[model samples]
Target chain A: MTDTTARIPKLTRKGQATRDRILQAAVELIAERGVVGTSTEDVRKAARVSGSQIYHYFDSKQALIRAVITRQADAEPVPGRPMMGALDCFDALRAWADAAIQRQEENGCRGECSLGSLAGELGAADEDSRQDLSNGFLRWQGLLEQSLRAMRDRGDLRPDADLGELSLALLTALQGGTLLTQTMRDIRPLRAALNAALSYIHSFAADQR
Target chain B: MTDTTARIPKLTRKGQATRDRILQAAVELIAERGVVGTSTEDVRKAARVSGSQIYHYFDSKQALIRAVITRQADAEPVPGRPMMGALDCFDALRAWADAAIQRQEENGCRGECSLGSLAGELGAADEDSRQDLSNGFLRWQGLLEQSLRAMRDRGDLRPDADLGELSLALLTALQGGTLLTQTMRDIRPLRAALNAALSYIHSFAADQR
Candidate 1:
């Protein structure tokens, strides 16, 4: 992040809400039309913000895109549970998967995973953007690993199980399942992939945990 | 596909080679710059094709993208053997995973799965494009199922194993792993995901196949 991004001005309460509203609108527009298809004018019109307001909160379109990435990383919880942070237990993990799947369905599988779309389109496009995406994914996997490690400490997982590999595998299944679900517009692949992952994790559980 | 797509012109021997050249060039350009970033003029220059020639073969840019999807679908083989088609036996499946992993490393994970990038960018943008991408995924999955069913008939798999669900799970893992690999620029996640998937598949092998 540049100095400008670092100082994305925090506003007074009213101005902060306006900033958030623009970010949400940008996310929806980009999700619907793709980055190339969306323009600053489109976002300004959608958010009911003036062109100056967009420039005020975001240094440029890339900075705005980065903010969207930050917003997505913050969408970790579903309802009341910590989707990745508390995923050590089976029920918690299952609930997280359920929330992920339900979000895809409820959205009609239309918009890209706010962060995932950036990963695919921007992963290879630029160094800074790719690093941002990589960090986002690692942060997510770290949360998953924390929960799995918690399980291991509780005698829930085998001492021999590789938590690093397991966490990577689960996140991989998720990214792939989410991609397929988005492409095919069917929830089965995500459900199956996660089910297989849950079963694989269960195989490591000590006496069903 | 429109009538124009159905009748994408077949050419004389030299003409066919030129068409192939255009497609290969388009794939590279799009992979590097993205669909919206790449233009027909860029393809014409990259492939050394005349403007008239591009128009003669493809009706529009969307048509060219559709052809790219078809080209990607044809990239299923890892080596001399059919990768997904012969994924019935354990060694064959492992080799296929190894090949997929190697491809990511060899390519420096620069491009999203050609098919997957399109799926994310175009899946929800338009209906016709989504159908084309959906067909591409189903065809790939069908090849997977064929070999899996072959294994079942040969008594390699447990009688009760749900091949349909298993295949879906495997593909899901692959897509997820590939996505992570692309994002993180690390080969470990793809390797881990595929290994987990293969282990999950092995759990259903009769006498470990």
Candidate 2:
């Protein structure tokens, strides 16, 4: 068995809870202060763990960041719906956008977006972080692509439309809009941008009909 | 006159050079270590300035950051090409993109984009910085809109296409692609994304008779 599996077998319920708490604290702190700004001490205080305990759980700060990225990837909503691959229409896509915006607002744009922050900071720092971030983005793009392909297959979109290109466009629009909204601390620009892009999506459907 | 303008009038040539040195050092450090990670001591060492001299030029770290932002913005490429805005063609647009990418690459994506970094970091912390960033983006977008309008008038692009929307789309794509490119430390993805976007733009061009 791998080291991870070996460790997993030894982790008690309490140990598991402590690990979860550490990961949660890391996420929140990294989001608020950014990767470079947040120190190990800050994570310790946030998690209410001692310094030794933190090191015990993870070998280094980079390892902790890796864990956070993994957690974020696991948390991503399945394409087309909250549950796995259920909804598959324009409305489903719209609903997903709405939920995403609401979640960002609730967070007050304080936390660096996990994937974006990781991509921005560590992806360039080291090979491991680069691969981690790239994989995360690929998975994200994959999720979106899955949804687009489903919509296309169902005749909700033009069959001839390039699904890969459309998926990239959608992800780019969403990400770009989020960056603007976060910096401006206003939802209007994001709403306008998304609405404009969605209108384009609608046009594709209309043309098909 | 504002306090800054009033004080600037009294600076000796030597003092001006010193100030320039400080700003240059701050920009380099910020690019290397990021805004939050860089320290006043680091700036002083990089500039070969004593702590007292550093303080003489700027009151605080925040002040130093603001100066760097102003200087970087001033140094950015002039918005309109020469000859009474006569440079209006696909070649001109491509030239602009090439210049932008070159400048960004030279800096190694070190600090957040000067404007983007300020907008992301201080846009919420201070009103003046917010205005500076917001105005910078607005001006950038305005320049693009003007170019798009010219292209439309020349029968290069579809007359019915929304210039404002298209301008925003182009700017957002460039910004988003830069962010990803810098973080990944690989320009290949950015090249792919940009090419895809440009192809889309080309598809909107007026067809030959």
DockQ of each: 0.69, 0.26
Question: lDDT by residue for model 2 over B12-87, one digit each (tens)?
Answer: 8899889989888887766555666678899999999999999998889877876776665544432334321333
Assess the local accuracy of residue A195 in candidate 2 as a C-alpha lDDT between 0 and 100.
52
Q: What CA RMSD would you report for each candidate?
A: 2.7, 5.0
Write model 1 residue lDDT over B135-192, tens digit each, in one string. 7788878888888899988988988988878888888887778777887889988898
How does each model score on lDDT?
0.78, 0.63
Q: TM-score each candidate.
A: 0.93, 0.75
Worst 10 residues of 2 chain B by lDDT: B78-87
Compare the candidates by lDDT and give the number of the best one: 1
Candidate 1 displacement at residue A162 in angstroms = 1.2
Query: What stretches of model 2 exceed 4 Å from their correct place?
Result: A1-9, A77-89, A105-113, A121-128, A152-162, A192-209, B1-7, B75-91, B98-113, B117-135, B146-166, B188-209
Please, what are the lDDT tens digits per residue for candidate 1 over residues A65-160? Answer: 777777776566244565587876888888888888898889776556466776766665666777777878888788888999999998889888
Superposition error at B69 for model 1 (Å): 0.7
